[model samples]
Target chain A: MTLSIVKNATCTFCGCVCDDIELHAEGEKIVKTKGACSLGESWFKHHTAERLYPDALIDGKPATVDHAVEAAANYLYDANMPLVYGLSNITCEAQREAVFLAEIIGGVIDSHTSL
Target chain B: MIYWGGNPAECHPRHFTKYSLTQKGKFIPNGRKDRTMVLVDIRETPSAKAADLFLQIRPGKDFEVITALRAIIKDQPVNPKSVAETGLTVEQLQDLVKQMKAARFGIIFFGMGLSMTRGKHMNSAGVLMLAAEMNAFTKFVAMPMRGHGNVTGSDMVMRWSTGYPFGVNLCRGYPRFNPGEYSTVDLLVRGDNDAALILGADPGATMPQPGIDHLARIPTIVLDPKVTHTSRISRVHITTAATGVSAPGTVYRMDEIPLPLRPALKSPYPTDEEVIRRIREAVAKKPAWRPSPNGQMAIV
Candidate 1:
């Protein structure tokens, strides 16, 4: 069994930053991954199926991605008093973008900070 | 010192295996065996069960118990009769103080149990003060057992994004951080915000009763990998790939150490960044509909 090093993969499953993980693949399939915690292992091993997509939903029915985005936009942009929250578990890039959205809408942004 | 609030066993499963407690110190060779573990808590927690001696203080009496110990450490008189309130005798506290003062190296860890209770930041402030005082006689340090995978990361992001830390306000076209003024609970309570976007956090599980009530009234959008109570009730429930597994990102540890997360699974779904990007683009442009004075959107 040969081990191949995978870099820049962020294990989002837990807090521990175990970076140097090896994904042993056999042709397109990742047969095994080494050097991750139990939570990390489970997060990586079991994510085989595609779950919910980021497309917006209107009354539990799938709406076009553009339509969903537009609806969300309308919700925030139309409101004179809006609050943009929840960016703690996203990438630094996403967080920055969310902040920009908040700024453009003249809205209040909050995270999970207990105040 | 196991002497305080941090319960790693319950929250951070690998804390003992990774950090100061079980990890070998430069001076202490034998790991946990060489160190004296003292647990000070209201009830017998899983971590406390492992302590060498458990000083069970009455609930909400941490400040009193700690203050008495601080007095004893300073060679001041602690009323023997008053010590009864702490559930531990004065002699026991004195003995613990003596050991703390004489220890080669000691560390105190706190948890949300302290930060979330009546004391809030003051409890952590007290713990930090205690460690500072201990430095006078012995080498001691303190740490908070922050939960959530990227909570510390979130804290660092907010601190750097805005000059101030959490509870930031962007109301006046500038970032003004006043905890009660800009906090989620306060904002929700006053019925100030018309819309909300929750990312990665499940406030339904974590918030207080009033705060939860406030959330139910707002137009909430939740983004997460799994279906949570918040996601179930959210006006817009957008599910994305997990950051470290399906998606890749960086996170910060409790010690403010930035680390990269490896993507273990290939996600066919849009990243949180993509979701936010699209939303920003849409919102930045003018909305198609306008709201009437009564708060209903009048379709043109």
Candidate 2:
């Protein structure tokens, strides 16, 4: 059995936003949690990925990260009327960037939570 | 207000430990013992377990409950059983109503379970009304337990940046808002979008069945640090550093105070801010990249 401990991490998953969380990371994978609520524990323990890739499919075909970025950029840039949504879930810095992106595209910007 | 909508115990585990009756808020120094905690819900919850009194109401009976409470506060004869299908007896409800009237300083907090359920914004409206009514009786306030740390901040920043709040249109070189017309659920459910950029949230897990089905048909981009229902299906699933924990930023507490986010861990992905910056750089060359009246982004 392996054991570890750490603290003072915020849980980004919910509104409570518990800022004190402790996790037992067994070499990159979290196995246990201390000082965290059940929800926070579940969030840290499960915040792992099963795959690692920089490239993805845009419309059912494999594309490079640059290609996808360019494509998404073009979609916003070329549109006469566009809406950029989804901000509440990310950090404020990301939200600021999104606002900048929306401005350049002359598009609408919104967070999904406003609904 | 009532816990009629959400079960905070299962969702927000530390609410009681940090802010509710069990916790000693700055005002209520005596904590649970000093405060009269009244719960109105459809079922028993962990938070209710510690309440001084509990009133189990029907699924969609919040409106009725509020009306009765208002009547009681006004010194009118309100029969509790006549108000709704709630399981609480008249005497139990009247006692709770009296406590609410007598509270020196009280806060009514609710969750998404209220907004998404039968009453929708009306439920919030009613709760807000209760707060107003209670003001005449005692010091009382109602606040929504906004789900994300900065979810409320998102709206605040958007509102401050643009004249309108959420669901605003910038295509006309100005901001315009129409709730259902530009809401996320409506946008997805109506299939009005050709592509989507999912950030921070997993619409697949949070959206209703119809909205989820519609999102599945579009070209979607996801920015998340972990695997989620939306990220798994997105065309470009770009991972990012967790905002509050891995990247320092700012957020608004439920009380509308802007709190600085503290980072506690290192991350491999770019901050949501960085990704947005990159995307903004890629799109800035467009023809209509004009700043708004507030010097923010405006439709050109």
Off by over 4 Å in 1: A1-14, A18-49, A52-54, A113-115, B76-82, B136-139, B286-300
lDDT of 1 by residue, B9-122 (tens): 665656676665687877888998887888777788898766789888777777777788788889999898888986889989888988888888787877766666666656
In the range A14-101, model 2's lDDT, one tens digit per residue, is: 7666666665556545677667787777666655422344434565466665676777777666555455777876766567677656
TM-score, chain A, candidate 1: 0.73
lDDT of 1 at A62: 61
Model 1 interface CAPRI class: acceptable
lDDT of 1 by residue, A10-81 (tens): 554445454566765443234667665666566566664265454556435666656756667777776666
User: Ten residues in a row with the worst lDDT in model 2 chain B?
Assistant: B291-300
Tens-digit lDDT track of model 2 for B176-290? 7877677778777887766667777788898878878876776667767765688666656666776655667877665666666655445665677876677677776655556
Residue B132 in model 1: lDDT: 90
Overall local distance difference test of candidate 1: 0.70
Please give the distance, in angstroms, between residue B118's alpha carbon in candidate 2 and its true position after superposition: 1.1
Q: RMSDs, each prediction? A: 4.8, 4.3
